[model samples]
Target: MVTSFLLLAGLGVLVVATAGVSWFMLNAMAPDVLPAFSTFLAVAVGVVTVEVFLGTGLVTLGAFLYNLSAQYSGGVEIAVTEALTGPPPANARALLLMARARRRLRTHIAPGDPGAGDRSSGARPARAQRETE
Candidate 1:
């Protein structure tokens, strides 16, 4: 229902704009009076019909292809979970800071050396180990 109405509304505007232009271009040569409302209505209906028919045809064709292929191989699977939406906890800022600091520490200490994953021992190469000294 929503889609139908929205399509109608969108295409109704297009029809009006096109009719406005047509009216100007044909006003001098055409009859003194024109069937403006009927012409606009007919064109609007035709536009809606074509748009719906094309959209439906494409979707049906896609589904048909997917079905034919799924007979031979397992189709793709998607997992969806209910989202958790709410305000963050009071410690959100502190948690973020700690996580960022840990990432920085990982990059700074023994980036390519063995035992690099042993940083859980709270070790670091501080400013005292700088080349400037």
Candidate 2:
């Protein structure tokens, strides 16, 4: 989505530059038609600018609308399973533990609770231990 917007912006700039160069060349080669050409060039640039901005605005609005609708519709679901391959690296386990700890802290810790150091004893509370078992 972001890539598409960037591409559109790049193309718009390229087209505007081309049009400006063509206008300049026309004025240089045929000074007699400069007035008429200048008027046409101004109108062309205005139209292109408006069209580009309008298109960009519509795309942005569409993305926001989709996000809002997805929030209500439960956007997407994904299922993941551990590979049957050999055990993961040691660092992988540490990273996974860190991620889980972060999630649990966010949901379980009170606003004024001391740091996670207090929970580092490696012993789950009785209720949590029971649920896991």
Candidate 3:
């Protein structure tokens, strides 16, 4: 009976470990998910950061769907093609689509985005603080 219990417990731990590894792999493959994951942990430790979880989630979902579609449709490089092409000059539709993409990214949490911070005020906070003092 003791031997049987030990076997079952080992099996349970093995199953849980396998599940944890699979979950890690899935998240690693998800687009923009790492930033959100780090942000969540930071928030738990009282650090505030804009992660744009909804935007990142949507992007990840889209990437998942795109990968699924590629498996069915002989694969296509959609994101890379869009970025490298920088919108087709002759096609108004492509330009319009690119414009919308730019606007969406601008409003969302894009890492290293220069326009991310509020720039209406001419001076940065440190300079303002010095002036006030």
**Best-performing candidate as measured by lDDT:** 2
Ranking by lDDT: 2, 1, 3
RMSD to true structure for each model, in Å = 10.6, 15.9, 25.1
Candidate with top TM-score is: 2
Score residue 18 of candidate 3 by CA lDDT.
62
Model 2 residue 109 lDDT score: 48
Kindly report which residue pairs in candidate 1 clash with one another.
none
Locate the minimum summed-lDDT window of 10 residues in model 2.
77-86
Cα misplacement distance, residue 19 of candidate 1 (Å): 2.4
Clashes of 3: 0
| Residue 119 accuracy (lDDT) in model 1 | 53
lDDT of each: 0.65, 0.70, 0.56
lDDT of 3 by residue, 1-133 (tens): 2333455556555655565565567677885555454454444333111223333455667777997899899998445342565446779787888899988855664456443466674534443445689
Q: Is candidate 1 or candidate 3 better by TM-score?
A: 1
Alpha-carbon TM-score of each model against the true structure: 0.32, 0.39, 0.23
Clashes found in each candidate (C-alpha, N, C closer than 3 A): 0, 0, 0
Instruction: Report the CA-based lDDT of candidate 1 relative to the real structure.
Output: 0.65
Residue-wise C-alpha lDDT for candidate 1, range 73-95, written one tens digit per residue: 88863323378755367678878
Checking candidate 3 for backbone clashes, the offending pairs are none
How high is the lDDT of residue 20 in model 3?
53
